[model samples]
Target: MNNQNSWKTLAVNLLAERTLLIVGIATVFTLLLLYPLFQMTPTLQASPNPPGEVFELQKDLNDKFPNSIHFTPFLLESLAGDVLTPNVLLEFKQRRQELFAKDAIGALAAGDLERQPYLVNYLDSETGVLMTGTHSILDPIEAGLIDIGTTLESASEEEVKLAVHRLISDPKTSAVLDFLSRHATHTPSTAMGHEIRLWVSPAMTFSVMTDNQKLGGGGLEIGVGGGPDVIAKEYLNRHIRDVMKEGSTSYAIWGIAIDANLEAQDEGKTAGIFIMFTVIGALLVVGLTLKSYWATAICGVGLGVLMIWLKGISSLIGLKSGLVIDLIVPIGMISLGVDFAVHALRRYKEELNKQYPPRMALKIGLSSVIGALILAMLTDSIAFLSNLSLHRSVIHFGSAAAMRFLLRSPF
Candidate 1:
């Protein structure tokens, strides 16, 4: 049509005559892509005061418990009956307390009392000790009257069986016995009448102790002064490792810090593999579908440029890209650009087959697809923008999509 011809002429003239403006736009987009404007904070709430009652609750909790953030590592242990009796438990507790006291003293002397760590066990609180029924037997254990090794060595098989049964049945020792039994690889039996044998069992003493420490005390928990940094977590892990190595070989340690680091490493590797596969697959599909090297290159370049421009706009508008945004933006832009380009190219080929002049064919192609492209862009923009009230991340995604649509409209 004459109107389409006129519009094409105007677009050509603008590109040819307003070269500086085109260059400036390109330069601005380049700078925006290269230099990001906003700092990315990958948290549940990226905004300073994100909307929602959940955020309000989070604020209230933070205000109430200023020093509540910390990671606690579980110290697991397995000990033989001869090595982990009530008296041995008492000895281990005393040693742990002594070590904590020594560390506290050293930290205080060095004026690093802020770095002092605390250890907690079942006996740390009266409630915990009472719950485990350890309070009643604490006196006997402390007095060194319950020497399990000596008794087991001297007592008859029947006496040992009776003693074991009595210990397991009493409320005072039942919890500890049950814990050890549960984690034990082999169950004990009095059926072997000639010789008394004790099997190795996993103990819940450390677990219960750590839990009590975490719940009843404050400093033993890691990350108290805000979520722990890498260095802090590593230091805590090292400290735990050192304690386990020096104190007893019977215990094993599993820290959140180590587990988190391993998980992150695994995630990074998986992402890298996925990205490689995605790039290869996209290239193969686009190249095969277009069949023309130039067309494939143009589509690829256009998609990259579109993403860069959208990211720049996002930066300018104080929007930070999170994992979801990073994934959605590229795929969305590619789908939009590819659909437009493919349809327009097909129309151009059809016009050329009808014996139209090259320039006229291009103009006709643009005329055929421009309306549809605009409609698609408008629909997509409206759909995304309508989700603004759902979540702040959705708002960010919608804004970026709208901006990309606007930037692509000129072409």
Candidate 2:
């Protein structure tokens, strides 16, 4: 106990008496860690399961069928309630043609051409198409309309209705509608039984049929199966969304790639704004409460260091961050960091009020609260570390949170 007390006293003396030296060392350490933080590239993808039976089976299947294509599907929902109308169909046709146009897609990849001169690499190289092929509800209707010497452009409301009737009355085409209805939901048919007529109901409400099966809500789903790989597929998906957003009236477009891009945008663009506001709010509150420029400066510096330590250490240790970690970690760190800073600054102020010498006050202030700080750190860390048994993301959150708590305690 005496030896422990001696070491504690020695630490306090070093911090209070040798303040410049301690600050210099911390500055150097922070600078060193910044390099790794800048260089660190975290994997942003989320994987819910470990590499166990499901993954192994998938790998085996993939190996068995090496050339199998995973179709990235975009769901488009019409805001106008019905997709079968003449105007909507004409709009869909135009948008679909634009999506398949090489020049239009090349324009989207204009800046990226320096890396690869050809946009065909993002779609089908042989066909020079943006996607391999598309499966759309508009296909059959358009085909039926074409057979009757009319197009989406020339067809009137009465002409479109006649074309739909002809398609539904035909046995072969009627089978296709039956298959589509069985797979898709919110599709209004003439009969409630298995045999039904299309276009009998105008109002459509497209929704998910089950957990695994996904159908576009009330609009056509464009299939992106022909892209060379994941990157190419994502490129197609993003451009498709852009076209739909610009050309269509009211539409909800979503897919794996589309959703991922949206999330990445939120994190990349909006997170900085959120962090700026959080820092500003914290500093403002601290300034008002303390009413001392020096105290506020110290708190701000401490908070900055704590954040740097958290990010720098996590980067150095190769911890990956995605949407969940990026959102949760900083908020948690800032909240805890502000609390720790306030307690230390308030304690230091109290010591100063008691008429202690500056050095004595510094030592006494830090020493008085450090034990409680350490206890809080340990408990917080343990609680976060308890998530080790959960998913990989949860484990990362827990580990990073715990580590940040430990880093903040010392500051």
Choose the strongest candidate by TM-score: 2
Among residues 3 or more apart in sequence or in different chains, the pairs in candidate 2 whose N, CA or C atoms overlap within 3 Å are none
Question: Every model's Cα RMSD, please?
Answer: 8.1, 7.5
- The list of candidate 1 runs beyond 4 A from truth reads 1-24, 37-51, 67-123, 126-276, 352-360, 397-411
Error of 2 at 143 (Å): 2.5
Runs in model 2 lying further than 4 Å from the true structure: 1-5, 66-70, 77-80, 103-132, 175-232, 249-257, 261-265
* Model 2, span 42-105: residue lDDT tens: 5343344455787567657654554323244555555665555687667766765665464333
Q: Residue 265's C-alpha lDDT in candidate 2?
A: 32
Q: Give the RMSD in angstroms, all C-alphas superposed, for model 1.
A: 8.1
lDDT tens readout by residue for model 1, 103-213: 555331111113544333334232223322122233323322234343432444444444445444456555545334355543556633533334444544332122222
lDDT of each: 0.50, 0.59
Give per-model TM-scores: 0.58, 0.76
User: Would you give me the overall lDDT of model 2?
Assistant: 0.59
